[model samples]
Target: MAMFVHLTSAANAPGVRRSGIRAASHGQGSARGVYCFPVLPSYTLTHQWLRELARFGSRGGLVAVHVRLDDAQEVLVGRYAERARMAQVVVSAAEAVRRIAALEDPRGWEVFVPRAIRPREVHRVRTAPQVTGWRYLPDAHGARPCTCFGCRVRGGYGARRLRERLPHPLDGPPPPVRVLLAQVAAGDPGDAAALREALHWFSMRRRGPLDRLAGLATHPDPGVREDLVWAVAGWSTPGVTELLDGLADDPDADVREAVEAARDPIS
Candidate 1:
């Protein structure tokens, strides 16, 4: 069972009027009573409030904080949403409404939820009543469309109306080897384009020139080291396997994994 808690104002009269919503907007009062509810945009809350909210989430409590892109804040990846350390289920408000309506709940929150969502309920677990697939249905009706993670993510609506901003560049000839190597040596953390182009130099055109980048084996950046591992794969260059063997115990775990993977590309 999914739950919603709309955040709205106290001055614009009756705040949120939906089922399970709370009405505590920006200016409720300086010293306000605290509710034990999971907060939306919990990142911006006071230290105490944030701690309490995080605690709720830690003990098997629901961590479904929904938000809409009303402004231009970039959606953070790995650090926010699905991959956030605490948040279990985060999505947008409009998507939540659509999903909730499909619950087919005979006597769920729809029975108690006001015509307006009252954001006041503290969330716990959200287990469904049962699970029935197409094979189990009496009429042999097929299961609902695949709402698996990959499909659902790909099914999300795109802003097709937005104009394309980037220019379409034609593929040009590769730069001379010396210039490419210079770029690779100068690559920095902020920009890996130079290093990537160098990797492209080795990957394409049936070339197996692994010896050219042998000096880069001890490059500081693990990313560069990892890329070198890939570039050397299937190249049959003499002493290349020995070099990779030395890097098998790379300091960076990712680099070590990359080295292991390169050891046997066919397998």
Candidate 2:
């Protein structure tokens, strides 16, 4: 048998002890399962998820549930960063343990068992140090964070403050429509960076001088043209739809993708 540990809320301890750790999806897909880490010789490494899980504000603190599973049992394993993309592979329980243990830095690794752990498979539920693992990402301390709108969650802890400290070029409150138009008009078409920035500001504000901005559809830089699609996506003005329809056939894949994303309400 291979040993593994699952960190969960202490509030569920009674139910967990009465039964076993129930299988549930961790926002990846419809496949419900219990998540665990291979038990390593190093105590801190074995419980590396404790601190990260606590960030979710688990009530009553958290506990570690040790489990035993057959070495031949199949499980899904992948890097924590790829979990949202469902980029995992099926491997035997023992193989998962060996693979993680062999990694020089196994900080972001995770395993997903496809079924509930039976009571007999549970070894014990015990108290764990609340501050044992890396938060955000492994070794993320002192690393510059990506403050893009997609990277930082709205209203998340420290998100507002972090954005204020380090604003992303493509994020934050956009300038007024008139200001963006003047910037775009005065910007050198050869200067892709400046043109892209002004266009991106228009994208954020979702309104601009459509006729003036539309001329950039033929800009040499595909990035500028891509930003053009986003800039006009929210416009209800006449000729906007026709302009977007023309952009839909852009030779650049990124520009075409931007056009498709712009047309989709949920994209």
Q: TM-score of every model?
A: 0.32, 0.59
Cα error, candidate 2, residue 45 (Å): 1.0
Candidate 2 global Cα RMSD: 11.4
Per-residue accuracy of model 2 over 4-97 as CA lDDT, tens digit each: 9998878878888889977765545767688899999999899998877776556678899999999999999989878887788899999999
Local distance difference test, candidate 1: 0.39
lDDT of 1 by residue, 89-140 (tens): 3343344344434444311111111122334433321221112111211222
CA-lDDT, candidates in order: 0.39, 0.81
The TM-score that candidate 2 achieves is: 0.59
Residue 97's lDDT within candidate 1 is 41
Mark the regions of model 1 whose C-alpha exceeds 4 Å error after superposition: 1-176, 185-192, 205-209
